[model samples]
Target: MNPAEQAPSYRGASEHYLSPSRRDPVKVLSEEPVTRRVLTEALAALALPDDRPVDVLDIGSGTADGFSLLTRAADGDPAVVEEARLHYVGLDVDPEMVETAGEQVRSPSASFVHGDVRSGIPGGAFDLYLSCGVPYSHLTRDELVGALRSVLTAVAGRGRRAAVVVDVLGRYSVEWQPNWHLDRWDYAMSFFAGGGSGISEPMTFYDAPALTSVLDEAMAGTGATVVSRTAVDRSVLVGRHTATGTFNPGVPRFRTLVNDLLRDPASVDPADLRFTPATGGAPRDVLDWLAGFAARWNAALQPYTGAGPLDRDAAARLAHALLGLERAGGPGLGVGHSFTTTLVVDPA
Candidate 1:
């Protein structure tokens, strides 16, 4: 067995964070208009038997954030969610996360499971598999490819039209984009202040090509064909999985700037790179979409420091600007570390 199979996932960590609390702002984002719009558009034509219910699995459903949001949406507005019961399984490699998922979170239709997604996924004939927040970057390239294949296979059990939706790093995003920023705060979200005790291999970024290759391999493994694949306004890729092929095109930004810099890093100084400032726009658009696009995060992160979830709104202006950069890549705040990208995948 590979190391991923041996690694215990801390699925409970996420549940603890998302537990019953108005303090759970992340859950708030998961429940917002932006997230729902994305999901609604993504799952529109899957056709999972509206007369009754359908089973959906979040292979790496951290903290039940996505589930909580979906559950609330189903309750808050059942018209969009046609299923009688939204059966869901949230799996993670860590035991604590699974434990937390079970204790908190109120949804009769949902259950938490302890399993390593790095190896083979759980045995369930699920109609939909939802993975959010580009979690695949937590694994190595080989492991990522393997994991994608595993997800498809798990959802494929004895069925012809199983679909898997995932958010991951764009391979084209790796080079010269000032990859790999140190993230202690978010790491603390796991509650392991120093990150887990296990010997961790530091994570890296991917370029566009590598991201595409993983999709190719995943499609081949599931024996599913790609029904749809498109970069949703630069930050997300939405694709439908079928019995033929799948195409995944992750977000791209710094890459466009990197090319410009490579041609002339000296001339690329100052205004060539602009650390986006927080500015507001339509509430329906993702608040952080633009902030995540900045070529450099240091300066852009200033207003966000010492702030909690509620404070993120203060940074909305910055996020709105970054959203513009998403459409037109640029630069800024350059000590070390930069760039954020997202990808989505569905089974054929």
Candidate 2:
């Protein structure tokens, strides 16, 4: 099988889903909320047809995770998107993934198909194109551009408004501080037990500028004009790899500490949450941003240090404060673990 066609090894997929890391407070409180916010904004920007259900195409869908995500984004709010009005098609290159998705997502409005976006997008034009899990990061830069160009061209041919959410690995995540100097490198799913298929693949990483360039090139002459682009950085400090320390050993186990704080504030020592970024390699601005964020993060923890186990209320408040700090840090410049860009496209 082509390396590109290889499905992410899910030998322990069930274990992974049931793992604490999957349901950690950071994932539920920060990552999912940010993603859902962007997805909601994208849906709101679209001009839906009253005559038919809104068509959605999920590229690189894995076991219909994107489908679940979209459902949550709608949150049964008819004003945003009604569950009954959604017609979802999930496309992937792995037949096993498609079959698994079909088995998992038994929605009347949802279907899964095997297809690779780099070669072509199956089904047809859609009102929204969605992807998650940084699937596009599996593609080379040129391949991603080609895949996106095909999507834009299809939207243009349809002559309708649409939205595309592109998710990719951020270049400057502290989890891989050592590789900030390189855009592409072997990234392993070390978080999984037994090293997740025990295979490392060369994955692409992107900053806002690089990703914007790819989108611009893909849109050029495709008769698709971007109405707006919103970039969001998810998991700036609490990325999964922070606990594994696989790529950057110097990084603190922020994910584990945060999860501990969420579960039982007394279990974590606030002093251990201090973030001291690895120096050199990354851009100065990125380093500075991390430094600034670290200062705030540490300060937030200072009140709890030596203060003994926090009461339930205090612990909840502190967690909320940290999440707020991440949100107020300004537009994402690829500082997070996952960088997502949602483009509202006008195929006029």
Candidate 3:
């Protein structure tokens, strides 16, 4: 898929919902201060030889936490605010996100871009690139290579050093399967206008190996070095990223749902594919609900976005049946099986 062209719609809602829902929610719950401390300490431990000011590029930098991290530590941080006037460039796929972040953040040398970080880095070399969430994990190998090429080109030309703090998906993270459709559904209904299927659909993802391998390759191409890295629980993954840990997919039955989702893109409607929370909805067991949603959505959406040869029409028909408010349980899981991957990305 053309990352640039197919980037808008999906990324739009993704940035909005994940920014607040997943990233903003569990800071305290997951002890963000501790994670921030780890970052500061990591920087401090860096063998950066020169006293030259470091220019930092935050890939998937949602809401500009990189700036905040430079100020004071988060919930459990022990690192003193070794503040530096970093030439910060924050990038996100969502144009609205970059706009909102630019308005709220203030820095003499800071800038925000409404461009694809996966398109590679912006002009000018950077010293470090940070990503709290596994944003790189979302890109394909080609885009990954492009992004790395951009980063390396910038720094190498300037004779500067660069490092990337990436979030790595451990083999066991909840909701880490080739099932991104559920997320698309939730993102659309909750953020986008109601929600409807369209031209080209996105591939369902949970590309752990691809993420790690691509990043390793990206870094390898760059003469930049890796100083220190660590990964804690999602209690630390703040702002728009899902909470780290195991979650439950509430649907009792799910195999059929998974198949249908893997088969069609326009099969189900966003509204029908949801889980109610405790205050009366179906369920909010993050893992369970998210997994179930993904399974059903993947089965239905994959046809259109075929990860392989998933029949387009058949998948759409199945999704349609599932999303038919009459077919789905109105506000429940109806009768489909669900899927989930524990959110366990070891950024170590």
The global C-alpha lDDT for each of the candidates, from Candidate 1 onward, is 0.46, 0.80, 0.44
Worst 10 residues of 3 by lDDT: 337-346
TM-score (all chains, Cα) for each model: 0.57, 0.90, 0.52
Q: Each prediction's Cα RMSD?
A: 12.6, 2.7, 15.4
Residue range 17-107, candidate 1, lDDT tens digits: 5535323222232223444544565556465555657677776666676676565543256534533477788987667766766776666
lDDT of 3 by residue, 265-310 (tens): 3443333333332222223343454355456544544444424443
Which tens-of-lDDT digit does each residue in 237-339 have in candidate 2? 8888998899989888888877777678777777788777656677677778777888888889888778877877777777877877765533668888899
Model 2, position 291: C-alpha lDDT score: 79
Q: Give the TM-score of candidate 1.
A: 0.57
Candidate 2 yields a Cα-based lDDT of: 0.80
Error of 1 at 7 (Å): 2.8
Each candidate structure's count of clashing pairs: 38, 0, 54
Report the CA-based lDDT of candidate 3 relative to the real structure.
Answer: 0.44
Clashing pairs in 2: none
Rank by lDDT (best first): 2, 1, 3
